[model samples]
Target: MGQGPSVIDQATFKEMGLLSWAIIDLAINWGGWAVSAALQTDKFYDMLGTGSFLTLALGSMAAAKVSHARKYLVSAMVALWAVRLGAFLVARVWKVGHDSRFDEAKKQPFKFWIFWTMQAAWVFITLSPLLLLNTASAGGPARIVWSDGVGVALYAIGLIIEATADAQKFAFKMDPANKGRFIDTGLWSYSRFPNYFGEMTLWWGIFITCTSGLSGAQFVSVASPLFVMALLFFVSGIPLQDAQAKRRWGDIPEYQEYRKRTNLLVPVPKSLFCGASCGPKSQ
Candidate 1:
């Protein structure tokens, strides 16, 4: 949980550039890869990401010269997020025994290495705001502003949505009668992928929280949220999940109707007024 002070000062960290964060990511992920490849498993991949975020957050704060309430608050948030999500995902993977997503990749050493590398990139880009803020030089006594409150509110909303959605799905899956049926109740009725919606919201929330500490070009860390959104929308998150759903239930009218009416990833209230006319069709 604790790391010794960075050997390189903030200035030297700059000289070395993003590589400082890059090295941290590669070191942690590649080390994780070594173990995963040896075992021929990807079960621990998400946990590794959780560890990367915690390290960037708490470790950077420990190595920082500018200590403030913001740093403490941000670091704590990151740690809390890591522990909650990491425990959940790790438990799920262990329950499932293996991640189907890695069925082919785990067999190829070079491909498995690429998966870990991409995971490293996910941590790096996603946690950039925290890294920048934690490593910044002291900016003098600054009052925590209204933005802090907004950030925390957004984060709480996101955390609740994501956690609740996952819990609901898990509960649904545990019921034997529900076998072969898709979840169209609870939060799933509001959004096909409420959990992914929660994931995007929380990352954006963290970015907004870090914005108070940022200025000028440093604001480019906006990629933290944008990358999350893009990754979910254009890349792995939505596409893979959607494809899997179609493969399983594509021919069923009920499943097709569910997709036709449910907002793909955004949670919206379903009502006869909004659903059939505007939002997802109501149950």
Candidate 2:
């Protein structure tokens, strides 16, 4: 079937303005916390955090005067990613019974609320590009472009890499023989945080696809991937994990060696001949 032309008009724009979307998105985030706080469990946070993105994306699509196939495709991608991540995180937290990250925060109402607000901000920044594209009164059905293909390829690669790394790590943790040992095999051999690399790549790909539909003020949506990268690198993902790993295994010669040989965030093939003592000293 042929793709339809864009149908966004002045009336549609007025009805689904950026501010309205932001308010709705933030409301969903804050609302999720009510259930979490009432139950006194943070296990639901992941599901709600991810579900918010899908909710907002679908909401925007529904608000559009004429939804194009591109809109549907982008929305589907966001939903797919969100569902996978949400399910994985929810399963993880459920299995663990509690998230240590919230142990202290949950005890203080204000601190807990701040964390929920941060989740709201995270959802807003990470999905900014998709949000803009979905709500914009832009051109006709998205034509397949080189960037689209490249973006899709990057996204697929990222998803596979992330899933693989998570599976490998989970399996390693489950093995009694691997107890107290760091995972330095499979994708982990290439980077200390291969999964994070994948996560960042996924957002970058999504941002690229957003560029296909965005214009003018919407260009500011580039912040989507940029924010994801920043959060993963300096703020939440890498820094925390790195610190935890170091605290757990800093004295182990092997882990120190592994740290020296492995890239911090980018994947690269490990040298086959590196000795236990060959790499640089730990920082």
Candidate 2 residue runs with Cα over 4 Å from true position: 1-14, 139-141, 270-283
Candidate 1 residue-wise lDDT, 53-144, digit = tens: 88877878776766788888878887888888888889888887888889999988899999899999999999888888877775223787
- Candidate 2: count the clashes: 1
Which consecutive 10 residues in model 2 have the weakest lDDT in total? 1-10
For candidate 2, the lDDT comes to 0.80
In order of appearance, the predictions have TM-scores of 0.89, 0.88
- Tell me which residue pairs clash in candidate 2: 6-140
TM-score of candidate 1 to 2 decimals: 0.89
Q: lDDT by residue for model 2 over 196-220, one digit each (tens)?
A: 9889888888888777787777778
User: Which 10 consecutive residues of model 1 have the lowest summed lDDT?
Assistant: 1-10
CA lDDT, every model vs. true structure: 0.83, 0.80
RMSD of candidate 1 to true structure, Å: 4.2
* 205: Cα error in model 2, Å: 0.5
> In candidate 2, residue 231 scores what lDDT?
90
